[model samples]
Target: MTQRLRQCPRCGTLTPAGECCGAVLQRAKPWRMTKQLVRNLHIFAMSRKGLDAETYRLQLERVGVTTSKDLRRDAYMALMRNLRALPDSPRWKPRGKGRAVA
Candidate 1:
């Protein structure tokens, strides 16, 4: 069998084909994945706990997601980096409007 070599864009190193080259080979963007996960999680949480969109948004904010575009960047990295945080149960909400709290 012959081995193939490919150049790694990260460190400008040549690595054997079919290798990870010590870098993450992301199939899709972290934000994209997190977005989808959030959507599904929202649906599930809503059905199980009566979480509305505003409530969900507030929950996300409490977990460090603070803005509409925040989820697309650093928040994405935060979610993707820590899988343990995903399964966490929703926290208690103080009595008030979600918008006012946000």
Candidate 2:
């Protein structure tokens, strides 16, 4: 197999195939890190629901993930953001009182 090496943009270190220098970059950008966290959370939720690989891909696609092989942090964030923006039903139970009740 041919070895593919690429220069890391931050440190200029040559990374071999199957490796990356994104960890440091991700740490530097809290928003990117948060997106990674949300992706992990989505994976965790999918696993908790006993979803298989195919089912997981389907769910990801439902949220605008075009390629299962290249799922991006932005896509995960968009999915979560859309989920959070969902409108609450008026018939739903009212939110509980705050610490004063507790």
Candidate 3:
């Protein structure tokens, strides 16, 4: 006997086992992947400023952080804190006597 496919509640379409309906699942949602990307970007930016992952991880552990999630969270928070502490924005400007026009 053949197993019947299940109907998706959101789109009323048939879906196989362990699959999701296309209409019900959005393709542009960024919440799932953005966090890791943001974390890596932050790490890369920090590295450009002379801070490496091992050093950052040691600093976090010195203050009682101990897991991958905690490390990423702390790194994100630290990056935000450093960014907020900057006196000027990190945008490019023309190399001349004229002031930067935003």
lDDT of 2 by residue, 1-102 (tens): 955565556676765633456533221222243555656655443433445567556666877774433546677666556544544433333354331310
Q: Assess candidate 3 and give its TM-score to the true structure.
A: 0.28
lDDT of 1 by residue, 80-101 (tens): 4443344533443434335222
How far is 63's C-alpha from truth in model 1 (Å)?
Answer: 1.9
Off by over 4 Å in 3: 1-38, 71-79, 82-102
The predicted structure with the larger lDDT, 2 or 3, is 2
Rate residue 57 of model 1 by lDDT. Answer: 71
Local error of candidate 1 at residue 7 (angstroms)? 15
TM-score: which candidate is best? 1
- Residue 24, candidate 3: C-alpha displacement in angstroms: 21
- Model 2: per-residue Cα lDDT at residue 43: 45
Model 1: residues >4 Å from true position, as ranges? Answer: 1-31, 34-38, 67-102
lDDT of 2: 0.51
Error of 1 at 74 (Å): 8.5
Model 3 lowest lDDT segment of ten: 24-33
Candidates' RMSD to native: 11.4, 10.3, 10.6
TM-scores of the candidates are 0.33, 0.31, 0.28
* Over 4 Å off, model 2: 1-39, 66-74, 77-102
**For residues 1-102, could you state the per-residue lDDT of candidate 3 as single tens digits?**
855566565765665543465444323221232667657645443433344567555545654554334544455466456544543324423254554433
Displacement of the residue 101 alpha carbon in candidate 2, Å: 38
